[model samples]
Target: MALVHHDPQDGILITRIGQAEITVRPEPPASASGAPVILLRVDAPMLDTLAAAYLDPDEARRLAQALVHAAEAVRPATPWRSPRPNTR
Candidate 1:
């Protein structure tokens, strides 16, 4: 299994399901947002594909574990930092 991000601006969302890899995402909008409200909207075809790929119990477990690990690894190590350093 692999991690996936649905970035419409970027393009396709690529990820691995069990041993197979797949790409799925919504079409990019014509307009852009000033304050990006990133939202992932997965459709039926993508859901069906994912469901079918993980039909096997063992495969599903493996995928779940992989997803957990992937999420953990991506977590920020520290809080955000300001561009200008604090001055006395």
Candidate 2:
């Protein structure tokens, strides 16, 4: 299985596949009412690619917020850790 790593500080998830790496991050919506978007960037020794997708705003917000929380959780004690993790 490929190893996956998360860097909450940068709001990114990375997966290593063979010799290539895939990175995922959230991108701001293009329109007020449009769905949230997730951007994907793939990099290999010889090539690179980029892609994105729009998803349900509610769901996206939940996910994005979760990631931000995760990023905070991994940090040393600080003010941002007061809030508990979401359970939904």
Candidate 3:
């Protein structure tokens, strides 16, 4: 969970994934009031070939909306909560 790149101007934060390190960067909104975009990139060091997949703002929002609806549709009657931490 290390930060590989942080572009303040573009408002991009690229974080190192796991051992293989598939980068995940969330791009800032196209406009001030627009939704954010998500970018998944594979570096040459790991993949031997560079690749990238971008989820545009519109698509990202649509996916998120659908996910929320799906969750709501399949939600259980019992609400889920985190367990309390054990104090020594």
Model 1 per-residue lDDT tens digits across residues 5-88: 556677547666655556543333435743222223323454454332212345445665888767656773457533556687
Score each candidate by Cα lDDT: 0.49, 0.70, 0.69
- Which candidate comes out best when scored by lDDT? 2
| CA deviation > 4 Å runs, candidate 2 | 1-5, 8-11, 47-88
Instruction: Please identify model 1 stretches exceeding 4 Å from their true place.
Output: 1-54, 76-88
TM-score of each: 0.29, 0.38, 0.38
The better candidate by TM-score, 1 or 3, is 3
Candidate 2 worst ten-residue window by lDDT: 48-57
Scored by lDDT, model 3 comes in at 0.69
Worst ten in a row by lDDT for model 3: 16-25
lDDT of 2 at 5: 84
Q: Candidate 3 regions off by >4 Å?
A: 7-9, 18-38, 62-79, 82-88
Against the correct fold, how does model 1 do in TM-score? 0.29
Looking at candidate 1, what is the lDDT of residue 15?
Answer: 69
* Total clashes for model 1: 0
